[model samples]
Target chain A: MYAFTYHRPDTVRQAAGLLARKDDAKIIAGGHTLLPTMKQRLASPGALVDLGGVPELKGIERKGRGLIIGAMMTHAEVAESAAVQEAIPGLAALAANIGDPHVRHRGTIGGSIANNDPAADYPAACIAMGAIIVTNKRKIPAEDFFQGMFGTALEEGEIVTKVAFGIPSRSAYAKFRNPASRYALVGVYVAKRGGEVRVAVTGAGASGVFRWTAAEEALKKRFAPKSLEGVKADPSGLNSDIHADAEYRAHLINVMARRAVEAALGK
Target chain B: MAAVSMTVNGKAVTADVEPRTLLVQFIRENLKLTGTHVGCDTSQCGACVVHVDGKAMKSCTLLAVQCNGASIVTIEGLAGADGTLHPMQAAFREHHGLQCGFCTPGMIMSAVDIVNRKGSDLDEHTIREELEGNICRCTGYHNIVRAVETGAKAMAGSAPVRQAAE
Candidate 1:
């Protein structure tokens, strides 16, 4: 890893100021993804603005009909948070299954979504739940926040502060994970809010996590597993790798979507 | 260079380290506590697992500077001051949980953490699931699972029982 100056800021304003001032400074929340990248020499920032010391960016609370999760809350904290569990059990489950126990203890939700790994689980939950990505600068809807694999709408010096997720009427996530890395091979998150239904797929999109509109439209008609009888995930833009071919991923997407719906319905 | 200070194994220690120095490097090189091993530099293997502020984390993945004020407990801290083994350590010895023993320190530390969070009454499935972070290359998981179960029970017995308030 390249040697870089490290700054531990006490507040979001100071952290953002450091990020804006440094030409090549990156925010370090949990440092799970960034540290590994640096270790491999894939990224070399001149400075690192550590957000671990920022008090404003740490918490999980329910606001009205949604939950406001601080950017610095670790996966373990989220998974164990009573507020998160009561508000969105699916999200809590997703947090519990990320990587392993050790990883969850240190990895934060903000880092996971900001990195925007194609196979990450949080993106699916955020998009399916219609979450709002709150940054120091502004708020971006989940649908518009994620651009593609390892990409987001975040501008330079913008730091994610919190994520607000609406309490879905019913929601559940089902994942087929890669045994080695525990990353999603093909994961699906299903959510229903009144008359609207959203189905998000991760680890299958060639570009990144995407909503399966056909499945969503079908489920909106009838919120049941049978509602997705003929709906299918098109293999055209799905990921194809040694772990799973595009066709296989497509099939798994449909299967996982059905399972997610079943789980949401307590079937 | 950054000056980092933290309590390791109940002792306060301070050192000057590079910003990129991993916590494992500080624990092993600067502090000269070599029980914590780094099997995989990447965060996959849990060989370097240690408790920071009372939670198990992979030391290799954490920068020493990040743990500047945090209290850390490594494998060397698990036993009593008089050399009494922690229940989990004793259980591993009785159950023969390790073969090569390369992963034993991490496995034991993670086991203690599991017991702390999940309670002493653990099922076989839960033990296996919780052991996801620590990988024993020997694949000696059966005995390790047994050891965790027994160790959890032993830990419960060793805890000071509180008297009921009148």
Candidate 2:
């Protein structure tokens, strides 16, 4: 890694100020992605504004009809939070299965969604559960928050403070993980609130995670595994790699969507 | 250079290191505690696992500066003051859980965390699934599973623990 000035700010406002002044500063939480990239010399930031010391961005609480999770809450905390399990078991399950125990202990939900890795699990949950991302400036809905892979609507110097998730009526996630890295080869999240159903597919989109409207429409009409009998995600813009071809991912999305529905229905 | 200070292996240490200095490097080079091995620097292999503030995390993935005020318990800290083996270490020795032993320290660190979270009453599947982060090419991981099971039980019964400075 290149030599860089390190700043450990205790508040989001202070961290934002540090970022605005530094020409090439990177906000690091958990350091799972940023540190690795720096070690590889892929990202050479002139300054690293470490957000690990910020206390305000490290909690899980209940607010109104939703659960507010501070941005620095690690994946392990999310996986083990009783409040999260009660509010959204699928999100808990998704958090539990990301990477591994060591990775979970260090990786944060904020960093995961901020990186917007195509194979990350949190983005699928965020999009499916209709989560609202609260930043230092304003709140952005999940759909608008994710622009593409490694892309977000967050402006420069805007720090994510928390994510608010409305308690869903029912939801579940199913993942086909790559055995070596444990990243999702193909993962699907299904969420139903009132009469609406939303399906989000991760690890397979070329541009990034996306909502499977076709599958959602089918499951909305009839909330059952068989309802998605012939539903298929478009393969034109899907990711195809050595792990799985675009056609295979399209097929796995259907299979995973079916399993997610079944899992959500307790079958 | 920046001054980084942390409690490692029950000792408060302060060192001046580059911002890019990894925690594993601080432990191995600065502190001269070679028990914590660095197998794969990419954080895939758990050879650099250690307890940071009571949770097992990859040391290679974190900078030493990030752990300035944290309490770190490495493999060397698990032994008794009289040099008695930790129950987990004894279990591995008794169960022959290692071949080349490249990943033992990290495996033990992770196994301790597993037991710390799930407690002593662990089933075989849970043990196997929880070892996802620590990989062992030798012994085919069968013996490691058995060792962790027995070690967890032993830990429940009577395992010597050093007082950690919170």
Candidate 3:
């Protein structure tokens, strides 16, 4: 790893100030993805602003009709939080099922969303639930936040403060994970609120993460596994790798969507 | 380098380490805690797993300077003062959970934390799902899962751990 200045600010404002001043500074929240990249020389930031000491960036709470999770709240905390499980059991289950116990305990929601790895699970949950990402600068809707693979709309030095997920009537995340990394080979998150249904697909599509409009529309009419039949994922825009081919991923999109629907329905 | 101080295995220690020095590196190198193996430099492998502030974490992926003033527990500290094996360690041995054992320290550490937080009632599916980040090249997961089960039972004080399942 290259040499860099490390600063552990006690407050978010101080961290933000350090980030704004350094031309190439990276915020370290959990450091699951970023640190590895740095070690591989994929990223060579001039400074590292550690967010672990920031008190304001680590918590989980229910704020009115939504769940507000601090950016630094670890996956383990999210998976085990009584409030999260009670309010969004699917979210908790997804958290509990991510990477592994050690990764869950170290990786944070902020780091996962910010890194936006195509196979990561939190993006699907955020997009499906119509969550709002609260950053130091502005609030970004989940729909507009993700730009592409390993990309988000976040500007430099803009530390995510919290993510606010709207409490859904019911929601579920289903994925066929890669055996090695446990990242989704093809994952789906289906959320229902009122009469609307949102389907977010990760790890399958070529665009990395996209909404399955056909599946969503079908499920909105009647939320059921059968409803997703014949609604094929566009294989042209799907990812293909050694773990799974495009055709297989397309099939998994349908299969996982069905399972997600079933899970959401408590079947 | 930065001057940092923290408690490791219930003892206070201070060291000057590079800003990029990972906590696991500091523990294994400076403190000579080689039991905390470094598997993948990436966070995907939990081989560098350790308890930070009483929570399991991928220490390889975290900067040592970030852990200033925090409490840490590594595999070296899992044993009792009298050198008795931790319940998870005993269970692993009883269940033949380790083959080559490269992943044993991490697997055992992760399992211990999982049962501590999730409880002894954890089903096989949950344990399988939770072990996703921990890779065992020997593929001894069949026994690892059984070990976690037996260890959890022991933790709950239900009974002496049973033999490996099937």
Task: Give model 1's docking category.
Answer: high
As a whole number from 0 to 100, the lDDT of residue A235 in candidate 3 is 88
Query: Model 2 residue A192 lDDT?
Result: 97
lDDT of each: 0.93, 0.92, 0.88
Model 1: residues with Cα > 4 Å off, grouped in runs = B160-166
Tens-digit lDDT track of model 2 for A145-166: 9999899999999998999998
- Candidate 3 global CA lDDT score: 0.88
Q: Write the per-residue lDDT of candidate 3 for residues A47-139, one digit (tens) a residue.
A: 989898888998899988899999999888899899999999999989988877777777899999998999989999999999999999999
DockQ of the candidate models in sequence: 0.83, 0.83, 0.72
Residue-by-residue lDDT tens digits, candidate 3, B43-149:
87778888888778888888899889999999888776767677888899999999999888888888888887789777898888778778898888999999998
Would you estimate the TM-scores of all the predictions? Answer: 0.98, 0.97, 0.93
Looking at model 2 chain A, which ten-residue stretch has the lowest summed lDDT? A227-236
Clashing pairs in 2: none
Off by over 4 Å in 2: B159-166
Q: Which candidate is the best by DockQ?
A: 2
Ranking by lDDT: 1, 2, 3
Q: How far is A167's C-alpha from truth in model 3 (Å)?
A: 1.5
